[model samples]
Target: MSGKDKPKSAPDVPGATKAVRKLGDELAEARQLHRLLVDPLLNTVRAERLRVSVTRSLWFFLACGLGFTTAGVQAFLADGYTTADPQWWAAWLVEPAFAGILITLLRWEAEMLARRLEVTAAVVRKLKRLLLFSTLVMNVIPTVRPPDGHSFNLGNLFVHIVIPLIVFFLAEVMPVVQEMCTRAKDTATVPAAPDVDLDQQTDEPPADIVRPAVAPVVPSVKLPPTVMTQVRTTLDSVRSEGRTPNVADIAKVVALPDNLARQLLADLTPVNGHTVPNI
Candidate 1:
């Protein structure tokens, strides 16, 4: 076959190559955006939701356990008394009263701990212990005595002992959980500082003139007439006192922030033998 008769290779399409390169660049940007912005936001929201869910679950379980334990205590107290007796009815109120006080104290402690405060009062500790001991005694005494003719119930005794202790420990640990969840939520919700790309920075001097950092001024807002008058009066007084008008003098007189005072002084003062227009 002649060399000229052989099929020639297809020429490279510049447009196809450029389009592929553009698509790759866009994909890379999307990935970068996800990593730098979207992912962190999603993770923070997820963490906040998890904390809320766990906190609610803890409270739900605590309520259920406390309700059951209160019922047990009521049963123990009312065991020997007949339903017709007023004492049997009064027994129901006894455990609930103690439990209510204990719960109130625990809630107070949780609030204090969540605020990073300590409940260091000796009375608080003593009172909490007293309430817990009272419930334990009421619950356990019935199990050991077993109402005369009945045999001692080891299972009843075990439950009565374990449940009260569990309640006590739950009361103790819940405050710590509240504190942790509050702190974690606060940390997650805080805006993160943008990550700086050190590699993109250069040592080369900028072509534009560098200016000293100043507080940004909003164009839509102007200084009040009263404030402008006060500033002008203060400036005149400072000049009369044989002192050069400055930011400190203006700030002291007008109670303005240093940056605002500085901006005001610049605006009101004459420059290069020219009078500045009133603002």
Candidate 2:
């Protein structure tokens, strides 16, 4: 209860408070720099990596489910056959063969859907259903009616039924998942379009100085008076129709080069207090 019994307060080291303040300031600055520079790069990498991880995880689980279903189908097909029989060996391949076709079709469908194509052919739908139904029927038959007078197994039946359905649904849903992931990855990776200010655009030049009568033309060559007159006539006709005479319009009417047409337009139109230079 005396002062000696009380623990001494920790001594304050010189500049400890200032050191802490300096450390906090440095950390704040580092965070700001990280956000400004490192975060964008990390975010892009993370998005692509995350998408790949998700796709791989889906495939891994689907593979496990399919393997389990294939084992069930193998058992059902090999039930009455001896190990030495060729039919017994062949039974192992049935589910995988069906699964291979299903995977191929689903992959093709996924690629097509990712590219925004429709896959509405009745044959494709029928074929997919047929494969799934065949696998389901094969997988569940042995469990539902056990051979050798063995009692029917509820556990085996449950597994046989549920695993095949899971495989079928996984097959059906993988394409959709792939399409969504592809779209999301594309959206994240595509660079944004640069912003434009439409108000700054104008048909007229910014200054009073006249542009060349025909850009990049040899000074030695000049348009004949008849050609100039024809250009003027075309411009007048365009104005009469209540349409602005642009380079394209002038070129179409007079069969002039685009550069010459643009120059001709500039020469023909008067800007503020500026005289048109003779071509």
Candidate 3:
């Protein structure tokens, strides 16, 4: 039939429109949950970000510390360490320096304790937003005329405003901060799957399919008491670190030379719920 002769399409029916809206809502909800899983705000990401926020935002912390320390240094330089001029370093630390020192110590402690990867992600996100708005307001400060008809100096512009703006941008690049942005974007999107042709069968097996097999049982192998204790300790350590205990860790635990440890591991069928290496 000619194109013109084809039947004209009908307008949307009430039932079909309702179905479409329902589908869209469901899709939106699914996308929200998917994004939450992909990028949680208060999980390990937050902990990690919190841990690095001080170090990553170094310039801000350093400046604050210096401002506080400057007064003390100046006092020391004034000379004459009498009762009036105390030389105590601790006494010299002021409010600004105290904040910096506290933050530095916290960050250092977290690092030693195995810092979280995104401990400061949320904080950075919020701070970056606040700083961006503040920058806009502050840049206008120099342009405003005083009652005496003189404009303020923006001579310290780069040091005070520009550098901070740059730091805010830098903070946004952190892994946790990026995750929050992605999470926001993801929630706004609808979940969608690619069109699939069910009738089109592929020659290859599905990736998720598992094939079971029967194997001959091997005789049990036993290790000496000392070796068993060492193996247990190594496995425990590996588990605590959230990893599977492999050949290397086992060797370290038992203090067995590499060749012997490897041979012993191979001989065992399974140890402490894990299969021996090379089995």
Candidate 4:
């Protein structure tokens, strides 16, 4: 078996060529799918969800930071063993540390808004309630007792315990009460959009002319398809004619009450064929 007997290193096998061809086909199929599929809307929704989630997480973190800052400040204020010459830097540092937490939260909140997320509205409401409760407690409790003469009695009912409880109640419970009131009003007040008079805009025109039509102010009454289609046509007519359509015309087309027609129109007009902001 000399060099000649080795016989030209066995002419590149058929199985190897077939395997390469199969691999190429699979790769082409993958690329074809990559080209044909569209995912921008799904990606957009996912991005929005992620933005809201991150905003919530940042607030939760800030809440934790607030707890730590409160504790740290309490300690600094209550430490009784003072130097003959007080440490001005350590005393000054406490104020700056609280300021840093506030500044970071402000920046993060700004970023959250830039993302077009509505998280700040809810957070602001909560913060206001907390501030109110804290102010109320500070007024009621003239002085906070210091524990061990080295730390403030943040654990006591009058300062830490009772104030936090009030804040929690205002932030959490008051919103529920407000929502219930809103929903109750909606139940009584909601009427069909077709019944709405476009000629008489609401108490005020929406801030943005092109703003999506407001959701129906009323709730609870669901319209059938025939009624909904009629409402859309009526709106198109109203917009085209530059005058509100007659109640009789709407009744003839959809057999709906005038109020119901108006409500339906209100809900569907500006938002026709478009998604509006959730808030």
Candidate 5:
């Protein structure tokens, strides 16, 4: 293609990166708001599904890298090695590249507040398993793995096994990282804004402070036995799924009018520390 015919790339603006980041932050905030106001429990499940996807993606990428590395090295060293230098492959593969990344995870975890369902490092704190796994991986390679090479060399053990084990220990001992983590709960515990009474603050005391007539409290209307029975059944079904019943959802599930469904929900109370929806 001629130089003039080629499409020109857009020039990067000074604050373009910052602007994009701001947009992303706003979007994330909106998502959190939706989760809180719309479907907290359902959104929790969705976030978990997303994390599983991310973890699987990472594993797939790592596997692909392994395959590519194997093929590329084989291709580069065209002729099969009658006497291959095991040390060269050991140097290339034995170093734990991800050890530092794991440390960052540890640091982040250390900064977090403890949760009710707290994580324990009982299993991971053991230095033995990390050493065992890294050593085993090193052994399985053709170029003589680190821990148990063709010969039992002290230098090989220190470089291949010791270092990797140290890295793993740091990942666990510094701060144990959970396989799954979560942000702190944003439960609707904040008190509603206090009622403002501006007239009470006036300098002149009123002769007769006329309090507005209070509206009569509404009585709970009794429903038909059949409808009430259906509401009870539907709520039980919802609770079984570990979800608190909402007006719209209860209406759909029980085939009741939205207003009636809301009325039924009002009669119920929050139990077991679960937040009832503000229907």
Candidate 6:
């Protein structure tokens, strides 16, 4: 056929052509939107931002430790070992510093334990909630108020500071701690059982099971002549039908076999009982 005389395909139809173009345009627009959403996550700036955040956190704890340690040691050296110091400034620095170190270590140790247990994330959330409650209680009670010492006023710092800082450290170290704990747990466990002894053979095949032969006692069942004749006729009919009849059917028209129907039926049934009636 000539090209002009040939039938046009669905895409070549005027309405279908417009629908295809519209669908293509929509798909392109959706693809563009997806790219725009994902681009920010893959950007170099975002990667650098994450790196800087982690670095800053490490430095922050290090700085805090150094500051508190320096203050404690300096104050202890400067003034003699009395609670009531003549120099109030040294007392302010020293007491709070000691407290800060103790609190920080407590947090660090608790988090370390949580991480080792592989429950850091769960423990952190619980600890944060607990710390917040503690902070609130401390704020409400004047005697239990936190000491004021550094630029980081821990009086209210307990509310905003320690809990979240501990949580961050816990998050950072948890995976490594969990891995170490898992390794330690595995090492501590008893080893698995070795393979079975292959030299010895198992018992013979199940189908070849050797049962002791017992001479069966044939029951002396004296059937009436009429019943016997009816049985013979029914059996013949069943044989002609090419299927064994059930015990119930035999009982209705004749005498049931002296042997159990299931035992006799198994021998007579065609197609392994599929063609026979079951009683």
Ordering by TM-score: 1, 2, 3, 4, 5, 6
lDDT of 3 by residue, 1-279 (tens): 998787654334445566677886787777667656544333345444543564456545545534533443333333344446555444454433433443454444344324222354565345446544444343334334222455555554334445445434443334434344333332223222333343466776479854446633333333444445546666666778987656787644333434545555555425576665431
Minimal lDDT window, size 10, model 6 = 186-195
Q: Each model's TM-score?
A: 0.55, 0.54, 0.27, 0.25, 0.25, 0.22
Please give, for residues 185-226, the per-residue lDDT of candidate 1 as tens digits.
433433344444444567863577353468334222135454
Find the number of clashing residue pairs for candidate 6. 0
Taking the candidates one at a time, how many backbone clashes does each contain?
A: 0, 0, 12, 18, 1, 0
Lowest-lDDT window of 10 residues in candidate 1? 215-224
What does candidate 5's lDDT look like per residue over 1-279, in tens digits? 997787654334455576786886787777666545544455446655654565455444534433333332332333233336664454444323333333334444555422313345565334335543544354334234322334655654444444434434434443322223232111112112233344357776467755446843333434434334555677778888999788865554233344545655766545685634322
Query: In model 1, how many backbone clashes occur?
Result: 0
lDDT of 4 by residue, 110-222 (tens): 55434322243677656555554543443334235444534434455355445445434433443333333322323323232233333467876667644447653454345
Model 5 worst lDDT run, 10 consecutive residues? 184-193
lDDT of 2 at 68: 87
Query: Which candidate, 4 or 6, would have the higher TM-score against the true structure?
Result: 4
Comparing candidate 3 with candidate 5, which one achieves the higher lDDT?
3
lDDT of 3 at 176: 37
lDDT of 1 at 4: 72
What is candidate 2's lDDT per residue for 168-244, written digit by digit as tens?
Answer: 88877877776665444433332222333344668876696466767634222134454456556777788789887
- Give the Å error, residue 58, model 1: 2.5
Off by over 4 Å in 2: 1-44, 116-118, 190-279
